[model samples]
Each structure stands twice: as C-alpha cells, then as structure tokens.
Target: MAEYSLRAASEARELIVKLHNSCLTHINEVTSSLKEEFEHTLHLESDLGQWLDVLKGRVESPQLNSAHRDFGLSLYAAASGLYRQAFSSSRSSLEVFIATTYLSASEFKRRQWVSGKLDISWSYITSAENGIYSQAFIGEFCPAAQSDRDEFVSLAKATYRRCSEYIHGNVATSQLLPTSIAYDKEIMREWISLSRTTLLVTLHCFMIRYFTELDFGQQRKVEATLEDNLAHLVSVRRILDLPVERSDS
Candidate 1:
C-alpha cells in the first residue's frame, strides 16, 4: 500500500477539517435564514404555515442527526490514523445523505409509509438499498443528475464498495495494516473531497426543493457562498480525475 509522510498527512487532515467546518456553517446559516423567513411571513394557523412547520420539522430533524456531519468529524478524528474507521464513516455518511435526498424527493404517501406511520409493522427506511432510492430521486427531481445518472450511480457504488471492503474485513483491509499509523495524503484527500462534494450536492438539492419560496437573490447568495467554500474540494476532485458537476445534481 502507498504511504505518506507525517507532514503530508497533517496537511490533508487540516484541509478536510476546513471543508467540514465550512459545510456545517453553510447548513446552519441556510436553515436559520429559512426558519426566520417562514416565521415572519406565514401565519401559524394558516394551511401553508402548518405545512411549513411540518417541512421545517422534517428538514431540521435530519440536519440535527446528520450522518454527514458525524462522518466528517470521524474523519477529522482519524486523520492521523484509523483508516478503516474513516472509510466506514464515509460510507455511512453517503448512505444517510442518499436516504435523506430520496425522502425529500418522494411523495407524501411514500414518506409517511417510510416513517412507519402508515404501517406499524413496516421497517423504517434506512440505507439507499443499492442506489435504487437515489436513482429514483435523481430521475424524478434532479434534471442535471438525470443526464449523468449512470456515472453518479457508478461512482457512489464504487465508493461504497471500497469502504465496505475495509468495514467487512475483506482483502482490502490489508491496506490498513501498516506498522506506522499514518494515512496516505493522496488517498485521504480524495476520500474527503468526494465525501464533502457528495454531501454539499445532496444538501443543495434538498434545500432547493424544500425552500422553494426563497427569493432568487437570497438563494443565489447562499449558493454562491457554498460554492466558494467548496472551491478547494472541487479543485481536488479535478486533480484526482473524479467526476465534476457545478450544479447540485
């Protein structure tokens, strides 16, 4: 397996931390702004206001328990070592984001069913289940994603499989057996870049769909800020020869 110097590992970890912080900041800002806007403009007793309340609950619930945030923190903690743990966390983050995006795109009936309200015996929605839910979400709601559906699914599956190898004690786990506890800078950079990009893209789509009433100017400003923060990760994606899409999809 490839190895990296301690300095290289430290630098990569720092960059990952920066990206993680920026992403969380953006999420908080957007959610706060949206909540304030809704509270000020919509009457609580009105039908639309009630609907907004439900939407807000749903959006905020997942944001609070975000696997993306959890995984990002795990990556930062394992920056100097624990390669297997980092990969497992990354896989978990991806699966959670996929499920969130799918729920946002699905119809109300489906969402209720997934929540187990419609059928007490039914299992709650969890994993993306081999990209089926994600594929459906992209097809129904994300126009830009539809064009690159095959590539998106392929990349997501490949990333999940690679992470799963480490998690499931497969042959690839041998890569983590080095005596020196350090991660390859190039590998860590790629993993963080991909994870951050996937998360931002999914969050962008969810926000756009949920905050449909957000004014154009405010929406543009929020998106511009997110893009600015993501600039370095985007560059890393290019350097690593990964797929790149400027849009949320």
Candidate 2:
C-alpha cells in the first residue's frame, strides 16, 4: 500500500488556490465586458466580492427579485456542471454508489444541481455528472490495471459524494440575498466567480491525481498540469459568454 505524501498534497493545494483566483479573474473580465451593454451601474467584480461578504452570514435580505434569482441559479447550475466535470466524479444515480458506500439522498434525483430543469426531454442529471469520469483521458493519463482502475473509480465516486454534499447541499443555505439592484448584480457576479474558482481547484486536484497514477514526479507535473488546466478554463469562459436562455412554456 502507498501512503499519500504531504509535499504532493501541498502542491495540489497551491494549485487549487491559483485555480480559484484565476476563475475570479475570468469572471470579472467577462462581467466587465458585459456591464456596458447591460447599462449596469455597479462594477460586477466589486459586487461579487460584496456578495461573498454577505455569504459569510453577515447580513440577510428580503426575497430576491425573480430575474436575479433565476440568473444566479442559472449561473450556478452551469458553473456547477463545468466544475464537476473537470474535477469531481460521475454522479449519475444516487444509488449507483449507495451500494458501495453508506450514503443515500433523494435530492440527487430532484434537485440535480444544474441551473434550470435538468432535462431536455428525458429525466437526466447531465450537468453534475457531465465529463465527470473522463474515462478516455483517465485511461490515457492515469492508466492502471483493471482492478486498480476500479478501485480508483470507487474512490472518486466517494469523493464526489463528499464534495457535492458540501458544495451543493451546504452552500445553498448561505444567508445572502439580493436586496437592491446592486445586490442583484453582485449576486450574479459572485456566483460566477465562485463557480469558476471551485472548478479550478477541482481541476488542480484531478490533474495531480492524474499524474500520480502515471507514477510521475509530483513537483514538475503539478506545475505543468496547473498551467494546462488554467488555459482550458480560459477557453471554457469564452464558450459560456452568451446570455442565459430559458423557456417557460
């Protein structure tokens, strides 16, 4: 049996922090780009920071306006999906892992953690589970013996359960609300910022785990993987620049 090393874990931690910061930066850039068109008075970047301040349970507001609520939820849904795919494990069915671990949840079936209703026509939790496995990438990079791969998959699933519970379940109870128009703007910005940051951290861990599977030297691999993941994150930001679209028919 192999023991986890502090040095590798530390490197991973640094990378996760960097990823989180990079995500904030990307979100700010995009928000600033759109502020002029939206005729928004508040600087979205600053609004996001303020939102985080409130999320610490410092203050509370009355009901958030529908537009802001919907926008924040939509961003959360998309960001959650992107992060899960890059970093977390596949969470197709709650019971899919319940047999292996002592965990069960009904919310996984109903509140599937995406922005809107989690379906095109079929009932599927595509967002949270999308790109989670990366079977092809894992096979190519983290190649392992059949038994070892199975074990890795199981562990990853377990990790997903833990992380999801923390992020999706716990984070929802945050005491913040959209009070003013500025508050609403801040809410959207903050959600976007946090989502990107979380995703970056996740990718950082995933890449380090990837290198470990290949028995590669940790220090060099960590640096290389962080850089690659950052670039990928930038590309993802561009792809999501379009306005949020949903239907109520």
lDDT, candidate 1, at 16 = 86
Q: Compose the digit string of candidate 1's lDDT tens values, residues 1-249.
A: 135687788899999887677545534543354444323222211322222334444643453256546565545544545556667777776666555554555557446745767532101332244243245544544333344444445566666676678678886555544444443444554455555444544444444344344555444434433343333444323423456787875
Predictions: Cα RMSD each: 15.4, 23.0
Best by TM-score: 1
Per-candidate local distance difference test: 0.48, 0.35
Q: Pick the candidate with the highest lDDT.
A: 1
Candidate 2, residues 1-249: lDDT per residue as tens digits? 134687788889999887666556545644565555232322332232332233232111111122234334434332332333212222322222221111111335324422245432211211223222334433444333222333334444454454355346345523333221122344344434433333333343233233343323333434443443343343222322323344398
Q: What is the lDDT of residue 91 in candidate 2?
A: 31
Mark the regions of model 2 whose C-alpha exceeds 4 Å error after superposition.
1-183, 215-225, 228-249
Record all residue pairs in model 1 with backbone atoms less than 3 Å apart, i.e. clashing. none
Report, for all candidates in order, the number of backbone clashes.
0, 2
